[model samples]
Target: MTSPQSVYRAVAREVNRASISAPATRSKTIVKNFRTIIESGGQSNTEHFDHDLANAVTFMKSQRMYKILLERYNPLHDMSAEEKVKATARRVGLDVPLRENSDEGQ
Candidate 1:
């Protein structure tokens, strides 16, 4: 039977290892704490969790989601507003040669 303190430290150590890439480490920590709550094995819906901590965890999840979206996904996902305008200009017969790699292609 593992002690609560041991479990706590193990979670911190493991989550810290993953934190660098995830940036959602704090939310993961909250999840670990919540597991600790259930592991205490009290029978009840009587457990009242802290709202502020939950909110913090929720916000961190959102930030991590968006960070992943914009940083890892946005570049090739769609045109930027300026790029869209440039495309429109090209469609209207302006000199917007859209291929940035035209010179390299030769």
Candidate 2:
């Protein structure tokens, strides 16, 4: 069996290997700018509010795209067919029925 330390190291390595794209970097910058605006109570003009609103929308769209990509490329997709079915059933608050004997269905 793999040790817990090895598993954690592998996860850390994968996380480090995933480099941030330009758009993600921009999103972080936008979030930081918005946070600063909010902290400084600087919503003094309609144009400023509009610009901030646009930034917020852009950030939300990027967040949604990232979520879709993550779901599509999830490692859980590597599960066997039977395991997938069991996972789906469990997700919906149901359980796959257990068989008493492997040859019973035959």
Best by TM-score: 2
TM-score of each: 0.30, 0.31
Q: Model 2, 19: alpha-carbon shift in Å?
A: 28
User: Candidate 1's error at 12, in angstroms?
Assistant: 5.9
Q: How far in Å is the alpha carbon of 50 misplaced in model 1?
A: 0.5
- Residue lDDT tens for model 1, 6-102: 5445545544543665664356655567567646643343234233334444565666677678868555347888787786787789976556776
Error of 1 at 27 (Å): 16
What TM-score number comes out for model 1? Answer: 0.30
Q: Candidate 1: deviation at residue 80, Å?
A: 16
Give the alpha carbon lDDT tens digit for every residue of 1-106 in model 2: 3333343344333333343665445334444544555445433664565455555555555666776687797846768999998988998999999868878767
The backbone clash count of each candidate, in order, is 0, 0
